[model samples]
Target chain A: MRWKLIIDPVGRPGRDNMGLDSALLRSVQEGGPGSGGDAFLRLYRWDPSCLSFGRNEPATSRYDVEKIRALGLDTVRRPTGGRAVWHDAELTYAVAAPCHAFGSLRQTYLAIHQMLAGAFERLGVTTTLASRRSGRAPRPSAGACFALSAGGEIVVDDRKLVGSAQVRIGKAFLQHGSVLLENGQDVVSGVTMGTIPRVCATSLGEVLGRSIAFEEVARAIALEVRERWSGSWSEESRSPETIESDKFGDVSWTWRR
Target chain B: MSNIPDELRYTEEHEYVRSESDGVVTIGITDYAQGELGDIVYVDLPDVGTEVAKMDVFGTIEAVKAVSELFSPLTGEVVDINTALDGNPSLINQHPYEDGWMIKLRVQNLATIEELMSATDYAQHIGE
Candidate 1:
């Protein structure tokens, strides 16, 4: 039950985001159990929009270079599986644990996701476990990661509210997901899709019946993780050594399929 | 302490080849591959009657960890695919060597099985 969780709101720059996550994974793998003193949960965000693809996806799957340049959005690859996810108008969370520390990887994911389901339930957003059959089965909107909910994803009214992916190396697992709270079409699609294609998005505005602050969502997640795992937090940020290594910050690894 | 059963032949990519009397060879990922893959979530099994060449990508297995390509250990025609994996890919993680067996193939070249490592050699090869 011992863990160390840190919650911080990180600004954009696609390479930096990937760098932070990869560095955290490297730290836990090389640093052994309790890397950075304990298990961690980092909350972050992106600005100016970005399309991030899975680590192993071919580069051709990333973006149409001309389209991306025309749209003025950043495109990069994540060191995780799944499909392309658009980041903007959403809160992203990353949780890292020592291998086999939190039971099995499946259990840990289910536990946290179940907690999220409960939290959303409490928030009056009725949702169910988005199963793989539901996900793998063809949906009209099957092209995007966030548009379709996969097994272990949370869906409200048949639309995905959260999209997640996981990566494990040695004894470390990095699971990250995004929660939508507003229509970010302007930042995301570069143009509004009429009423923002509300089909694939559910915001706190819709859940709470009114607009909600971003901090409140982050706090709720922090409290959920803290309470579920019985952990305390600290205000320390990623070390300068890690940031300076430019390990993940490099465009090569960021864009490398 | 590893789970390389004495009866199965092995490939470097961790697929096991077991020859039956009818000249059909049952193939599946070895225990080591399943262990490294963690909990299997989805398995992309090749369709029956498809031809696959040695070292070619036959299909893929998506684990909670990552999605990895499954390589063919021999050139053969897939006579049967484990349909059970469509709903229970975790079978590979739960029983990689047996109930999780992925495909049964009509061997195009029986001699290739000889090129595969024996269980003891695979154990030694993977440093088990």
Candidate 2:
């Protein structure tokens, strides 16, 4: 099989969510059992809502740390790079596998986005992939991830719909992103420090003209996954070799940049 | 086709190593790597005096599409990093071999560099 499906529908804390994704990425990198054939598509949600920073995003200097705490928002830094994303009321998906599973880094990114676009289509929501910008792009220094869409990102009504990021290590890589079920990214702009750009974003409910649930979105994605890859999807537990992540939950790691 | 300079040696991970002196060698991603990564937005490298093992991640390069680890090709201590990338990471997309050079290391074993892929070997490695 080219893919394995791990649907963790229950919400968990930000640290543990990021930790599982990081550990799964390492499992695919090291190459042993339970690594999934070519990829592991783990779909999950966040508990109590969380704000995640890109691995290198300057959160300590730009984000209102005190405000985030006071708001009771769980936070963690993703191993992948992009910008800050408010992971709330969303269906987050992580794909971890060998780099060659898709192809070159750029190809891998676009291919995954294509799968996501197809999934959205099954849910009757049409999406277009953003083109690569000619000049500058959104930097990791500040601003919300949904504030702008990079080339190859997924969009609807010309607003950013799915914000994704990737990180490559040796022979393997991990790419993950959020498919917002509700309009939650607005919270990001409120917490940023400087006068950052407002979020140009959309959500499944907004596009579908109704409220959307995580299960409906997950079903559409799972159907797309089945059609895209050969063989049946397996529901496997976490790989035993995956290391426990102390850093994902650590403040030092989150605020390291 | 991406240029593979004849004088440089390369790791399978796509990092190029250029001999700077007796024990010092400069490291950076190959033209092929920058091409694969697309427009670079930022570069994060280790500080001077940081020791790294061969194949260990010393830093990461963030492109518009992805962020990839920069693996150490030769085990050594960091001597310097390209601070120029702090402001204009596009230097990598513009001239990855020259202005985009990432790090300098005082190699623990100079002879190991000889084991790295030559330009001809790298061309084949990338299926050029």
Which candidate has the top score in lDDT? 2
Once fitted onto the true fold, the runs of candidate 2 whose alpha carbons sit more than 4 angstroms away are A36-38, A236-245
DockQ of each: 0.15, 0.67
Q: On residues A65-116, what C-alpha lDDT tens digit does candidate 2 reach at each position?
A: 9999898888899888888999888999999988877788878888889999
iRMS for model 1?
6.0
Predicted candidate 1 versus true structure: per-residue lDDT over B1-128, tens digit per residue: 66988888998778999898677999999888776555566677888899999988888776643655688899989999999987777778778877899999888989889999999899998777
TM-score of each: 0.65, 0.92
Model 2 C-alpha lDDT per residue in residues B1-128, reported as the tens digit of each score: 99999999998899999999769999999999988888788898999999999998998889865888889999999999999999888888898899999999999999999999999999999999
Best by TM-score: 2
The DockQ assigned to candidate 2 is 0.67
Which pairs of residues clash in candidate 2, taking residues 3 or more apart in a chain or in different chains? none
